[model samples]
Target: MPGIPVTAPDAGKSALRRRLLAARAALTGDEVAAAGEALATRATALPDLAGARTVAAYVSIGREPSTRTLLERLRATGTRVLLPVLRPDNDLDWAAYEGPDALVRAGRGLLEPSGPRLGRAAVTGADAVLLPGLAVDRRGLRLGRGGGSYDRVLARLEAAEARPALVVLLYDDEVVDEVPAEPHDRPVRAAVTPSGVRRFGGVEEVEG
Candidate 1:
């Protein structure tokens, strides 16, 4: 983690990230499990999700709102789910999500697919992407951990001119009024919470 320079502006994002992670860690195991089930139901109900031919998602680590149920449900329907494998450079390489048994523990507390690497650009072919975040606001701005991993993914998506339906899965409280944002931060298509789905950028009309 050394040698990475931190800017003064990043203080806002760094602080918010810590607070959100703290709140998330307070939730009990039962609470997390229940939220995962609810998230699966609400997320899969979205047309973008229900209709996706391929989805790029991640394995939930720690107390982050669980995505296992949703991932499993997606696979059960024959959707080709992709999970990220963290590269040494902190950029992501993806692989197909076969099942829970197919996941191998990578360092830094991540569970990645043991399947063949599909290369970085494989995400451009996805119909939808399920992103992990500490919070997403009404403006659809997502607050990610300070790692800058997903930021690179979004940049890759943009450079490819891929317009995949960008979505974030979070707890209801994580959907907020606002979070720190920068000029390069692009709004997500929608945010799926345990209670309901919040659409942004007229994404609902597309799903309609």
Candidate 2:
């Protein structure tokens, strides 16, 4: 939710983002709930998540695939969960997820962890990162809201030389053959959809 808005030069990407957001907004509340549960089931089974001690994830807002269920499941399994806090500059800061009760409403009508702030660099310690996206290409390029928050997150990880498994959560249809790519966009290792988990090139294979 913290990505910067796409500019005029990104007209094409902007149009696609609007279309996808509109389609997501069309889902019924019940449909979103069911998809969230199914996505959690599939995501929790990934070996990347299964072995993770610290996972960098975010609270799903609006019609996005819900990370709420997945967050709780990760905590239940003794994993330390980190959620993002939006910085004024649109960069993301980190905070530990204490549970649903620990969440507080913040800017742009989104929920954020109500815990001590962990520096932006804190994400470098993650074993995996569950990214939010409107769509991901087979090449694992994630199309995030123009806000650029996760873009900074990825850059931070790269600067720190962290090699955490980067995973995206989306509905089954959001996995496309391709999306508009940018020079700075980093490829994700995998995507977890309600239908199943899909791995891309350079990703580690998850065992059944």
Candidate 3:
């Protein structure tokens, strides 16, 4: 007989996320390209991008598909881009980004910007922020890589009364009804999937 079963909800969800990440990484080249195209297209149409003076976006890494095209497009529109730097204290340090060249390999083998190190004050000035996640829900809850780095940064943003629009990027199937949100989890305002953007926790109806 099998050993006494363990059935913690959190444990089950963690297992599911691991499986999902593995499967997502196995996506075909065509699938990845299509998804990237869709994300870029929808991002261009986002209302937040129209007048955003400052924007913060993550530099993609690993099996994570590239956002080079999207970043280039955003830069062309004159939106200031800022990238996150992993600090030793487990918090995020932001830096001004001019282009791809500003990036250098950093924490967890991810590429990060090598520009002027800005403080949390710069994050508060941003009109929009693009967050990274393993999965997300319509409620704006995100499942990150368990670093708590983003949560820490977002918490600072919340305390400042300058709530920039938070957007999480994910694959289409990664958008679900619910995700296990911890007490310290910082909720986003919306999610951008391969199909389109969904306004999480918003009253406005989302159009496909």
CA RMSD for every model? 6.0, 4.9, 5.4
The sequence of per-residue lDDT tens digits that candidate 1 reaches over residues 1-208 is 0011223543488777777788788999999999999989988888898999999999998898899999999999999999999999999999999999999999898999999999999999999999999887667789898799999999999999999999998887776667879999989998877777778884432221
> Could you arrange the candidates by lDDT from highest to lowest?
2, 1, 3
Tell me model 1's lDDT, rounded to 2 decimals: 0.86
The CA lDDT of each predicted structure is 0.86, 0.87, 0.76
| Candidate 1, pairs of clashing residues | none
Candidate 1, which segments miss by more than 4 Å at Cα? 1-11, 202-208
Off by over 4 Å in 3: 1-13, 202-204
Which lDDT tens digits does candidate 2 get at residues 1-208? 1123444554477787887788799999899999999989988899999999999999999899988899999999999999999999999999999999999999998899999999999999999999999988767789999888898999989999999999999887776656789899999999888878778887534323
Native-to-model Cα distance after best TM-score fit, residue 151 in candidate 3, in Å: 0.6
TM-score of 1: 0.91
Better-scoring candidate (lDDT), 1 or 2: 2
Better model by TM-score: candidate 1 vs candidate 3: 1
TM per model? 0.91, 0.91, 0.88
At residue 128, give the lDDT of candidate 1. Answer: 99
